[model samples]
Target: MLFLTRDLFSKKLTILFLIILGTYGCKTKTSSEQTAEQAPALVKSPEFNADSAYQFVQKQVDFGPRVPNTAPHKACGNYLVSTLKKYGFSVVEQTFKDTTFDGTIINGRNIIGSFNTANAKRILLTSHWDSRPFSDQDSLVKNKPVMGANDGASGVGILLEIARVLSLQATKPDIGVDIIFFDVEDWGATEQDTSMLHSGFCLGSQYWAANKHIPNYTAYFGVLLDMVGAKGATFLKEGYSMQMAEDVVREVWTTASRIGYNNYFIDERGGSITDDHVPVNTVAHIPMIDIIHTKNSVVRTFFDQWHTADDTMEHIDPKTLKAVGQTLVQVLYQESANLAL
Candidate 1:
């Protein structure tokens, strides 16, 4: 995803006004801080297993960079499909063809996994799975592909672990959960090219938002994860998210703070990003927020190794995964129990 600069923001397509809904209401409660007022029938959400999530990240890295149309990409896609199936999710592989900024026709697949499909109220979780074909940001290997351990695999790993845990749980979430892995997201023009900035990026999400796998699919709200497994990560409230779904962002960040993850989920506003969530919000009309690592550093808005060959397993931290994964689980379970917004 590209950071939204002043120029880009000015040139951005107008986002449709989102009709926000209020449905959940609950005071924050941690494992050790449950009061009588908050203790009544609230279900304690399961602890996220960081180690398992790390292994899932490692497994994807072992397949090398998952650049779309490559052998490794195909193999990894199959593995993801099988893993979701093993977790008992109703899977949908929506395939499409699109031309890249360089005029290369790429075969893309947006993978969807649905849990508790019978329920009308659903929550959406998503992340891009395909790695960039070229490391344009890396001066050393500009032509090489990025490993994307934290950028691509980390979010998917967390969602995979969530699926595994939900499958084993006797009491399922009252609301349905839909996990989507968007492909061909990073096959876009370099940062220097301002003209192709927004139009070239997020191809997969644009397709999925326009042509959903299920007819007339909708979610209560959605969360998109990116660059979530680095050590000492900080997730600022994204600009578009604040504009489209401020209440959902408040709920998620507030939940993170209650669960001792305040250090990661910062309370500052971040620059608007042209990511998968944008299309989901604008085209599909589903309010979705991006939980991505951003910083006020001089070097970069994202992680140190973003879009570089150094984005490997060495940079991934299990603690960060646990923070994000556990917070998501808590939010899901809280919604499942019919808590008021």
Candidate 2:
């Protein structure tokens, strides 16, 4: 997740009356009538295993800091590819050399796994796999590498658990699902570095958005998970998500609310962030929304441990992972049923 250094400033709220209208614009049918017409067989989403997700997070952290140009990074990349293949997914790795903010070029890889590859309707779920290079936000050790347990590994861990369930299913969903682990997303310069480089952060996403793995890949929508494992983490509607993909945001948030995760998925608007979803929305033209933790009451940006060395396994909460993972499974299962017709 990107940090917002400036003070909290509000932008003019874009009235999303159209979305509200469309959402409520059912053909003038009464509530009971609509319920009768729409209520049908509901697919039960499989339970998401929090223990397995936590183990995945721990496995990544055990690799030490997954910073680029490091042995841990390379090993973790290989492990991720092999793990997805073992889960019965069709895996593809996109490797490239990315130039960082400090003029250092490092090898990066974007690992993708597809389920039900023959389906035309698709949903893209993504998270960054690389840990930050420096603990710039740490008060005591400001220059050390971070473990990125919550920031990077947590999201991928949840997705990996989802992949495991998808692999074991007897009847696969009709819609295709792609899980993308983007690299070089955490190599951005510190806030102290005042360089004018706009695309320094999220290098892997920028590359993948421009040169997609498939020739002309597209999805119905995309959901990006970031900083999701912290305890008491609240996910507000990010500004960029509200601007770019309001419908997707509503769908995910509404699902979260329905699943009793309303406390974690708040309804307030949050500051605009420059994370991996930016390139996917702008370059790829895929409506993508970021479900990220925000520090609203006290700190105005991300969680307190963000960018800090303390962002380790101790900061990750299994409850939070289960909440997010369960909600995502529900969303996918419901979307699959809708797309089947």
Leading candidate by lDDT: 1
By summed lDDT, which 10 consecutive residues of candidate 1 come out lowest?
A: 16-25
Error of 2 at 298 (Å): 5.5
- Give the true-structure RMSD of model 1: 13.6
Model 2: CA > 4 A from native: 1-42, 192-199, 298-300
Query: For residues 1-341, what per-residue lDDT tens digits would candidate 2 score against the true structure?
Result: 96544443222122366566677785477754554456444568888999999999999999999998999999999999999999988999999997898889889999999988998899999999999988988889988999999999999999999999898888777789999999999888776355644448899999999999999999999999999999989999999999999989977887787778989999789888889999999999999999999856654488888998999898899999999999999899989887767
lDDT by residue (237-265, candidate 1, tens digit) is 99999999998998888788877899999
Q: Give candidate 2's total backbone clashes.
A: 0
TM-score of each: 0.87, 0.87
Model 2 vs. true fold: TM: 0.87
State the displacement of the C-alpha of residue 203, model 2, in Å, after optimal TM-score superposition: 0.3
